[model samples]
Target: MEQTLRETIRNNPKKILGVNPNDAKVSLSYLTVAFVSLLIGGILGMLQGLERAGLIQLPSWLNYYQVLTAHGLLLLVVFTATFTIGYQYANLSHSFGGLLSKVRKLAWIGFALMLIGVVMVTVMIVLNEASVLYTFYPPLAAHPIFYIGLVFVVLGIWACCFGVFINYRYWRKNHPGQTTPILAFFAMGVFILWFFASIGVTIEVFTLIPWSMGLVETTNVMVGRTLFWWFGHTLVNIWYLVATSAWYVIVPKIIGGRHFSEKLIRLVIILLVILNIPGGFHHQIVDPGISQSVKFLHVFMSLSIAVPSLMTAFAMFFVLERTGRKLGGKGLLGWLKKLPWGDVRFLAPMIAMISFIPGGAGGIVNTSNQLNQVIHNTMWVVGHFHITVGVSVVLTFFGICYWLIPYLSKRQLTPKMNKIGVIQTYVWTVGMALMAGSMHIVGLLGDPRRTSDTTYGGHEIAVSWIPYEMVFAIGATLLLIGVIIQVYAVFNMMFFAPKGHTEFPVAEPEDDATPAPLWTERWGLWIVLLIAVISMAYVVPIVDMILNAPPGSPPIRTW
Candidate 1:
C-alpha cells in the first residue's frame, strides 16, 4: 500500500509539477514570491516613505487609497501565504517521515487559487475600482468583485490549512505517542489560528457583499472593525509565531548549541495562543466609541502579551551564550565576538534580534491609549512595523532558506558571496535603525503618518528634516540592494550551482522523542477561543454604547 501510494504521488502530473523539479525548486518558489511581493510593495512603500520625507509632489490622480490598499493586501497575502507554503512543504517532508502525493495535489490547488485572487485584486486596484485600504471598512465601499477576489484568496488559504491538518494527522498515526516536531507544531498552530482568525473576514464577505450589492440598508463599521481586528491582530501574531519557530529551530543550530528549555518554549507557545487573540483592541486605542474601561482592559492584556515575547528573547540569548561558552569564549560580550560572524545562520538571527528591540518598544508606545495620541498615524508607526515584520521576520525567512536550500538541493552555497550577504545584512539593519529613529523623532515633533505633507500646530515646519529624509531614502535603497544581493545568491545556489551529489549527514532519529502530547496539541485553537471570549468581554459594552447611547452620552474619560 505504501509503495503504491508513493508511486502514485511520483506519477501524478499536477501533484509533482513543482516538486523537486531542480535543486532550487522549493527555495526559488519562496524567494520568487518574496522578491516580487516586496518589489511591488516596496514601490508603494517608497512612495509612502518619500511622501513622509516631504520630498515628493502629491499627484491628485495617484489615488493613495487604492495604492495603500493594494500594497497592504498584496504583501499580507503573498508574503505570508507563499512563505508558509514553501516552508511547510519542506517541514512536512522531514517531520512526517515523508510527504504524501495527495498533500502535494492539495497544495498545488491552493497555490493556483491564491494566484487568481492576487490577479483579481491587482486588476481591480489598477482600474481604480477598489480603494478600501485593505481594511474593507464598509460604508467606504469597493466593487463587489473586490470582495469576491478576497473570497478566492481566503478559499485558497483554507485549502492550505486542510493540507497541513491532514499531514499532521498522518504523522501522528504513523508515530503514535511521539512528541510532534517543534516546527510542525508551530505550523499547525498558525493554521489553526487562520481557521479561527478568518471567521471575521468570512462574515464580512457573506454579509457585506450583499450589503454592498444594495441588498441591505446599512452595514456596521464598528462591528466590522471589531471583528476585523480580532482577525488582524491575531494574524500578525501568526506571522510572528512562524518566524519565531524558525528562530527556535535555527538559533540552536547556528550557535552550535541545544535548546535551553524545551518545556519553557512550549509554555511560551501556549501563552501566545492564549493572549495574542484577545489583545486586538489595542489597535483601537484612539477610537472614542470604545469605553475607557474596555480600552484599559485591553491595554493590560497587551502588556501581558509582552511576557512571552520577552521569554523568547531570554531563551534565545541563553542558548547563544551557552554556544559561545562551548566555543571557549569568556564574558558577556565575549560570546558575541566568537560567533560564526560570516555565516548566514548567525548573521540572520543577530540582525533580527537587533531590529526587534526598537520595534518592540515602539509597539508598546503605540498600544498605550495616551501615548498613542502622540504617535498614532505618524511615520513612527510605519517605522515600527517595518522593523518588526519587514526587517525581523523577512530577514529570518532568508536565513532559514539559506541554510535549508543547500541541504534540500544537495548543493553547497557559493562561499564568498554568502559571506558578503551576511555583511549586507548588518548594513541593512543599521540603515533601518537610522530611518526608524529619525521617523520616531519627527513623529514626536508632530508629523502625521501616511500623509504626503503636513503642517503641525498651525505652522508649516521648514524642511529642517530633509537631511534625515535623505538619510532614510539612502537606507531604503541600501536595504533593497541588500535584499537583491541575497536573492541573487540564493538563485545561483538553487539553479546554477554545480550539483555534486553529496549525501548530507542526517540527524540520528530520537527513539525517546514521542509525538508532543495530545493535550498540548492544537494549543493555538484554544488560544483563539480564549481571545474571542476576552475580546467579546471588552467589546460587548462598547457595541452597546454605539447602539444605545443617546445623541450625546457624557464623554467618558478614564485616562
Candidate 2:
C-alpha cells in the first residue's frame, strides 16, 4: 500500500504538493507578503488614527485618496488573500487523506501568479499611475497594468481552486460514500463561490483596463460598480468562510470536544453560499440606479445571511459547553472557570468570539439603509468594518496559526511568548472595540471617513473627539506589538521545534452495515447555478437605473 501510494503520488505531483505541500517554502513566502502588507497597512492605519486625533499636520504626498487606496488594496487583496490560500494549502493537506504531489505543484503555480500580480499592482501604485482604490470603480481610472495585475491574481486563485478540486476528487474516490470532511468541503465551497464571483471582476479587468488606458472610447461606471460588488461582496465572504472553518475546527480542539453536528455544519456552508451572492445588492443601497424593490430584496437577503452566522455562533458555543461538561466542569459559568485559560489557543478563540459581538452588531447597523446614511463614509464606518472583519475574523486566523504551527512542526511553542501573544490579542480586540465605538460616536457627530482631516462648512470641529483618536493610536501600537509576537512564535516553531518524524493520529474505524448514496451525485448543482443566474438578472436593471439617471437630478442618497 505504501509503495502504491508513493507511486500514485509521484504520478500526480500536483495532488501530493496540494495534500501535504511543503510549508517551509510556500507558507513562508506567503507570510512574507502578508507581513509587508500588514506593516504598510498598519502604518497607514496609524497615520489615519493620528489624523483623526488632529495631532499632526497632513503632508501633500500623504494624499488621503492614495493612502486609502493602498491601505484597502493591501489589506483586502494581499494580506487576506495570501494568508487564506496558504492556510488552505496547509489545512487541506493535513485534513484530507495524505499528501498528493501534483496538487502541490498547482498550488505553487497559484502562489507564483499571486506574487506576479502583487508586484505588478505595487509597481503601478508606486509609479502614481494606479491610485484607483482596489475596487477600480469606473469613471475613475488607473493604468491598464493595475487591472491586468488583478487578472493575473484572479487567475492564480483559480488555479489554486483547481488544486482544491483535484484533492476533493481524490478524497471522494478513496473514501467511497463517506460524508465529505467538513473543513475540506468548506474550503471547496469558498473556491466555488470565488470562481463564480470572479466572473464579474474578470469581465471588468478584460474590458475596462484597455478602455481606461484610452484603448477604447469609454467604459460604464454603473456597469463597473455592479460587477465590482458581485466580486466584492463574495470576496469578503471568501475570507469569512475560511475564518468560519477555522472556528469550527479549532474551537472544538480548544474546548476538547467533537463538533456538535456535522449536518448543521454542512447546512451553514450551503446557506452562506446561497445568501451571500444575492446580498451583494445591499452595497448599492446608496445608489439611485437600483430599483427600490430590488434594493429591498437585497436587504432581505443580507439579513438572511446573518442566520447562518448566528447558527455558527450557536454551534461553536454549544460544542464548547458540552466539552466543558465532559471535562467535569459544573455549572452555567463553571465551564469558563475550567477552561485552560492559559492556553493561547483557548484564549485566542475566546477573545475572537467576544470581539465578534460588537463587530456583528455594527455590521447589521451599517448594512441597514437608514442607519448607513448616518455613518456612510465616516470614521465610524471604518471602525465598524475593522472590528467585525479585521479584528474578529483575522484574529481567528491568528489563533489558528498559533495552534497549528507547533503541531505541524512537531514542537511546542515558547509557552511564555505564546501566553503573551494571547494577552496581546485580547488587548488588541478591546482596543479595536474602543476605537470602533469612538468612531461610531464621532460618525454620529458627522465626521467623514477617508479624509486626512476635515473642516465642516469652513469651521473646524471641536477636538473633543481627540481622546478617541488617542485611544485608537494606542490600540494600533498594541495590536502591532501583538502581531509581532505572533510572528516570533511562528518562527521559533519552524526553526527550533523538535526534529523528528511524527505520525498523524489514525481515525478510528466506524461500523457501517449499509452503504450511503452520494450527496453530490444525487443533488444536481443546476439549482445552485439557477439561483446565481437569477441574482445577476436582479442586479442588471439596477445598473441600468444608475447609468441612465435623469440630468440635473441629484443622485439618490439613502439614509
Candidate 3:
C-alpha cells in the first residue's frame, strides 16, 4: 500500500512538490555553508576587481594576492562545490522517494569534516601564511595545515559521494528492473567523474602535506602542475556537470516545455565520461615540457569535446523551440521571442547557453598551441573563464539556488522576490558583457592576468590598459550588486520566510512513454570507458615527467 501510494504521488505532476523537510537536513546544512561562501567570496571579488582597476589601493593589512586567494577558494571551491552537493542530495532524496535513513550518519559526519576544514583553512588564510593563491603551486607553498585542511574537505565530500552511491546501490537491489531516476542517474555519472578527478588532487595532497611538513626537501614542479591541471580542469568540469544537469532537466519545465530526448541526454553523459579527462590536456597546451605528439593527441581529443556540446545544444534548443511554440510562438524564428524573459528560472539558463558559444570557442582556441600563444596567460583567458564558469555556470547556479532552496525549505518565494531574482540575472549578464568583452580586447593588446600590479613601472603600454581595467571595475560593481540581491533573497527565504510549499520543476520528457535503454543506467560501463581514456591520455605523459624530471625546487614563502 505504501509503495503504491508513493508511486501515485511521485508520478503526478499536478500534486504538491519538493522533498520533505525531514528528508533534507543534509542539503539545508550545505546550503547554509554555500550561501555564506557566496557572500564572502563575492565581497572579496568586488574588492579585487576595484584594486585591479587602480581606483583604490589595498589596505596595508592585506595584499592583492591574498585577496585573490580567498576569493577564488571561497567562490570556486566552496560555493560551487557545496551548492552542487547540496542540490544533488536534495535531488537524490526526491528521486529515492525520501532520504535513506542509513545515510543520515554519513551526512552529519561529512558536514562536520567540511566545517572543520573550512575553519582551519580560513584561519590560515587570514593569518596570511597561506597566500599561495587557489592553485597552491609549489614552490609557492602554503602552510602545512592548509594542505591538511584541503585533504579533509575533499575526503568529506568523497564520503558523501560514497553514501549516495551506496544508497543507490541498495535501491537498485530492492527495485529490480527499474531504471534510476533521471537526476539520480546524472548525479551518479558526475559522482563517477569526480571520483576519478579527485585522484589527481589527492595525489597532490599526499605530496604537499608531507612536503609542507619538511619531510621532503624539494618538490617537482612539473609533476605538481601536471597533477594540479589533472584535477583543476576537471574541477571546473564538475561544476559544468552540475549546471548542465539542471539545464537539461529544470530549464525546460521553467519555460513550459516538455523534456528533450533522454536517449540523447544519456549519450551526452556517456560522451562526458569518454571526453572530460583526456580533454584536460588543453589546460597544459602552452607547457613545453610535454611533447608535441602528446599535445596533438589531446588537441584532437579536445576538438572532439565539441561533438558532445553540439549534441547538448541540439537537445536543449530543440526543447526550447518546442516550448516557445507551445507558448504561441510561430515561424522559424518567432519562437525565440516567446521565451520566459521575466522569469529568472528560464532567463538565467538561457543566458548561460548564449554565453557558452564564445566561451567554448575560446576553449578550443586555447587547445591550439599556436593560437594559445596570444591568449595563454592574458586577460582573454580570464574573459573566457568568466564567460564559461563565471556567467554560464555561475548564473545558472544562482537561478537554481533561487528556486531549489525555496522548495527544500518549504518556503514560498513571493512574487516580489522572484522579480528581484529576474532582475539580478539580467544585471549580471550585462555586467559580464562589459567586463569580459573589455578583458578579451585588452588581452589581445597584451594585458596579462593574475596580478593586480598592472603598472610596468611607468611603461607607456601600461597607459593603454587603464580604460579596460576601469570598465572591468564598473562591471564588477554591477555584478556585486547582483550577488547582494541574490543573497538577500535566499537568506530571507531560508530563515525568515513564512512556511509554504513550492512546486518542483521536474519536466516530464516529451516522450515519457518511451523507456530509456537499460544501459543508460549502467554507470559501470561509463566508468570503464572513463578509466581507459584517462589511462591513454595521462599514463605516457606522467611517465615522461618522471623519467626526465630535474632536481625539484625548494618551497618559497612569498610573505
TM-score of each: 0.86, 0.87, 0.96
Taking all chains together, the TM-score of candidate 1 against the true structure is 0.86
Rank the models by TM-score, top first: 3, 2, 1
Which lDDT tens digits does candidate 1 get at residues 279-388?
A: 67787888767878888878888888889999988877877777788898897678877778788866886788767777787788888878988887776776777788
- Error (Å) of candidate 3 at residue 316 is 1.3
- Candidate 3 clashes between residue pairs 3 or more apart in a chain or in different chains: none
Query: Could you give candidate 3's per-residue lDDT for residues 244-274 as a string of tens digits?
Result: 8899999988888888778778788878766
Number of the top-ranking candidate, with lDDT as the measure:
3
lDDT of 2 by residue, 255-329 (tens): 666665666666787777766766566677788666776677667777877899899889777767767888888
Judged by TM-score relative to the true structure, which candidate is superior, 1 or 3? Answer: 3
Model 1 steric clash pairs = 178-514, 178-515, 179-514, 179-515, 179-516, 180-515, 180-516, 377-449, 378-449
Q: Which is the better candidate, 2 or 3, if ranked by lDDT?
A: 3
TM-score for candidate 2, please give it: 0.87
Worst 10 residues of 1 by lDDT: 550-559
